[model samples]
Target: MIDISRTLNADTPTWPEDEPFSYDLTASIADTGSVNIGQFTTSCHTATHIDAPFHFNNSGLTVDQLPIDLYVGRVLVVDVTTKQRITPEDLALIDLQGVRRVILKTDTWPNGAPFPTEIPELDARLGSFFHEHGVELVGVDLPSVDPLDSKTLDTHHAFEANDIHILEGVTLDGVEAGLYHLSALPLKLEGADGSPVRAILQEI
Candidate 1:
């Protein structure tokens, strides 16, 4: 099995001006005379995470309400490294027939690197393209599918309009392009717009 999730640490990069991850011992063995207790606080969008529709739309489903099957199953890892803009035409050569999940390996965000100021742009049309191909889930190695400074989130809304789910901030370094069994379920966060996920892949 290969772990594709990013490690959550105090140094883990977060969105601009957003909350960074933090962890500390709330009660240690010395204080409790028992087991150590720790507590952590982090933005739901930090690290490897799945974004429920509620992330962009207040009326959309929450993280806990998402279907479990959407995150598990055969997934195709398409290597589109170095491409500044990803569009449907770039994926024309791939055999997407019957593929329900696709993980784009951008190789842009190296593990433990500082938060990127810029990354590849995902064309809004790919949303309809994926939906037409019957894809239910789309994952990316970058922090987000849309541009960092984007306020409209055109690509995000497009995917949601097409009923496609989004998984972001995955660490795809060293992972090759091919098909694998993916398991990247979100935390059962009631009413939350997003949740951190432990994304993993296994040879099929």
Candidate 2:
């Protein structure tokens, strides 16, 4: 299995002004005379995570309400690293038939580096396009599907409106474009907007 999730740490890049991930030992073995206990605090959107519809829409589903099968299944990984603005036309040749989950390998954010100021933009049109193709989930190597500074979050809303889910901040640096069995289940955070996932891909 190839782990595609980014490491959560103080250094893990998060959205601007969002909370950075931090971990601390709540009870040390020396003090408790038992196992060490640790605790962590982080923004739901930090690192590799899936955004529940509630992340944007007030009436949409929360993290716990999402379907588990959407995050685990046969996924098609397509390399669109050459385009800054990815659109349906760019993916015209790739066959997405029967693929419920698709991961775009932009390779723009390689090496699990700091948050990028700019990255490729996934056109909002993909929301309907993917829906038409029966795609349930869309994953991206970059932090978001829309532009980083986007205020309207058009792509995000489009996906949500079309019943397509979003998985962001994935690390697909060395993974090639092909079919793989993906397992990127999110935590059962009740009423939360999102949750970090331990995303991984196994060769099939």
What 10-residue stretch in candidate 2 is worst by lDDT?
A: 106-115
Residue-level lDDT tens digits of model 2 in 4-95: 99999888888888989999999999999989999999999998999999988899999999999899999999999889999989988999
What number of backbone clashes does candidate 2 have, counting pairs of residues 3 or more apart or in separate chains?
Answer: 0
TM-score against truth, every candidate: 0.98, 0.98
The local distance difference test score of each candidate is: 0.95, 0.93
lDDT of 1 at 56: 89
Q: Give candidate 2 regions above 4 Å deviation.
A: none
Instruction: Give the Cα-based TM-score of candidate 1 against the true structure.
Output: 0.98
Worst 10 residues of 1 by lDDT: 10-19
lDDT of 1 by residue, 1-204 (tens): 999999999999999777899999999899999899999999999989999999889899999899999999999999999699999999999999999999999999999999999999999999999999999999999999999999999999999999999999999889999999999988888999999999999998
